[model samples]
Target: MIKKSIVFAAFDEEYVATIEFKLAKLTEERASIEFITDAGCLEAFLERPKKIDVLILPYGIMLPHPEAFSKTSIYYLTEEEMDAENPAYIYKYYSVKRMLEKIDSGLITEAESEKGTKVVGVFSASGGTGKTITALTLAHKLMKKGKRVIYISTVPYQDFTYYIDDASVLGTAFCYQCSINIKNALKIIQDEIKNEGFDFLPSFKNLPVSYQMKFSVYSQIVDYLRDKNIYDYIVVELSSELEADKLVFLKNCDWKVLLTTQDKIAVGKLEALLSNMLDFDRNILILCNRYKYNQPDFLSGAQLLQKYEFSEFIEEYNAPLDLEMTKNSQLFDRTILCME
Candidate 1:
């Protein structure tokens, strides 16, 4: 969706910080707010008559030239009084819920909807099932089909970086620092795209385990990319061990692909995981990697359906050790084309 441009004029430092914190909780990509702390800066901005969808002014702030913003939608942030006639006033210390309600209710001008970006997540219950290969090949295939695609590895230790040779990996630390500002994050991503041939956000290998578990930061980075509407598709590679926060991130995705092998242990673990995750049944697709048609199955398809409540098993693809060979083959044809 296109982001609405909002200009907030508040001189108080404490108030500005509170508003910033409130704004960070907003989930929709409807508005992009610009905060002005100095009164002079606000006045100067008003004098120039910038193209802004919403102009938020502090209660009782004197406007030297109110006529200049005649075309702009003006709202007052007041706590003591709310004008009955002009109901465009919001409480200065309103909760984030109320603020979001106001924005969704058309009291605040809404952002236009642009072309939506699709997010696909690839996950597994255990490691070494070719999850990274599936994600990377899907991205390469989508890009080859003339679609803008970015591959993000959210796995711990970021083993996926070794597959993409000669690319400068943007560690999780850099992402956490820059994630506060969407524009700054976009600049970094653009610079990386320019230097590297492909679009990717590398793993956070250098970060401590505690820092790496900040799933909100990871979600913000993905949301920034989606809101920017820069790519047609985003393929996310997740860690095998799915925590509560990781499940929260997976629930936000448009599609979720679960990769598992025919090993009895892997299938057993997957069955246990699926029993607890009944909500994702509709959007989740179970992919059995490295299946041989002639070989007897350790975990049969019927058993998977009966045990895990899966609708059906997706077609299996041969596992190729050579990354280049896999990309050139039809390994990702069914998955990528089906998504489109």
Candidate 2:
């Protein structure tokens, strides 16, 4: 049986939380729920990137263009008296069970999935170039703006758990081994990784396990997440070492961010690497981290861009060495956010 997909768009956090809590009681085999609290995100979601079986919005919230979502069945939750003749109207502040009953009565219909999610891959030629930091910071910034974002680290030696407390290392690995459906896998992820503000899937637990899993399995997991239409963005932090498997995975991403430093050796490696890459201009952005002016020995930003013939090159300002401090700085606001 196909699981019913439901989306709740509302401005009240408490109301959203209550609905989420109650929905968690339902079996994953029967239903899936996605919540949207941001107005912008709600608007984007209503665009119907994917088929939404039911969309719940509070009556007070203004939907600028109702006709645009004529394909989506909309239900208004109102505390005051609603049009008794309108079957789409549900009494607000009702129990979760009652609300779900209204949904089950066939107020909305489900359709096929839509492709709208964008996957971004952050990669570097070498370690210690702030690839993971950049990925996490970008995800955080998007999440701050009320976008549904998830971070996935494909590094063999997992360090993402250390930086982000309560992260579920090898959560995806568990799902893969169990051969769980995407709906159940998503539920497991939401339960395992809690209170992190955003979702994160860490690398494998050990090298042996990592080697045992094929690259195709990794691709399948990412593909399933992208097709689900649950998240707005998937930011991936890849390993520094490049292999055929890694390259294939990176190529599938919607966007690629190549991180590098001013070190001559690093720039040389990057230049040599980019020479053999095909279609490097499309959806690719090169970022020079820890940038400084009037540097000697190391290549300048303009020099690096000219040598590589890159379409887009950005100079990331040097920020505090501390991770927490760096996140609050202008680095992400001014540099990372500028990217599409």
Candidate 3:
């Protein structure tokens, strides 16, 4: 594949080097990077440019003539007000990952790449169904199996303070802000994120502050993440409380894992609900979570993939999965096989 040419320029050589290293790591060394440490060299290079796909430079430098690099998408890096206002200005103060994400997202659709991303939506009709735990365990297992995995949580007022330490890790919120112009915005679903060696956007600050905008910002981000071909598996943990957003998100998933309790009395209602709503998708899988050996597999009319009874805390499953250590590997492997 022909890699895109990216030229990043700044006055500080150390800062530029950090960005270069981070960008190369993030892109898997698939991008061609050119750095300019001297303002004189940058100006000289701008005098006669080649087929550079993207140009990002300090906002302090005077922008080159528009016709100089006609085919290039130019971005100005700024710490404060720009010398000249432009839509392509990127905040210099943001983290290196965030800055690179903004740059990468700009040209997301330009490259023709194959996607390995498979979205798994963990949802439940009712709460306390082990939805979040299931999602996290699945992500951990997939990571152990050598699949690039990310977990996203959409619970309102969530605080994974320990998981995400940086208060400045505003990936979800920043991605939402970019989604305001969803049409012009790159067709990416989630901001490229990492936490605890398990990729994820941190918990939301004031989740979905705009209802007038997209129904669920996450609904689109997951789809974008898949199309971008970044990760192999994307496990999303959604709140059972929000039905409308759940519906919107499930459409993008390759496999939908819906959890429910062993309530035989709720059978008729669940059958009608799953049939009327989720029956449209063949990939939907229903599971009776926290099940004993005797709990009915077909809690409703749907097929079952029940989670065996467990006494250990959910955190016990945090480390790399050892198939010898547990029985849930059966569930994890089955879901992965379907995705593969």
Predicted model with the maximum lDDT: 1
Candidate 3 per-residue lDDT over residues 1-340, each given as its tens digit: 6788889888876346335544665565457888888978988888767778889988757656768788888888876535434558886544454455666754333233345788888877677666665677678667766678888776664444443334434555355654466533343324436554568766544544432334456666677767778888889887766476677667557777766666664444445556667543556655555554455544534343222211111222345333233334344433443333
**Candidate 2 overall lDDT versus native:** 0.64
Q: Give the local distance difference test score of model 1.
A: 0.67
Record all residue pairs in model 1 with backbone atoms less than 3 Å apart, i.e. clashing. Answer: none
Worst 10 residues of 2 by lDDT: 105-114
> How do the residues 1-340 of candidate 2 rate in per-residue lDDT, one tens digit apiece?
7876777877866446445644656334567778888988877765645766677887866666677656776788776446745768876544455466666833223221244778888888867788777888878866766678888776666676666766444555464653434445555554544436767765555652434655555566677778887788888888887788788778778777887777788778777767767656555666677665556435454354653322222344555354476566545443343333
lDDT-based ranking, best first? 1, 2, 3
Q: Which of the two candidates, 1 or 3, achieves a greater lDDT against the reference?
A: 1
lDDT of 1 at 311: 19
**Candidate 3 — which residues are off by over 4 angstroms?**
1-115, 159-192, 207-214, 242-245, 265-269, 278-281, 292-334, 337-339
- For residue 237, model 3's alpha carbon misses the true position, in angstroms, by 1.8
Which is the leading candidate under TM-score? 1
Report the error of model 2 at residue 240, Å: 1.7
Listed per model in order, the count of residue pairs whose N, CA or C atoms clash below 3 Å is: 0, 0, 4
Candidate 2, residue 296: the lDDT equals 46
Candidates by TM-score, descending order: 1, 2, 3
Per-residue error for 145 in candidate 1, Å, reads: 1.4
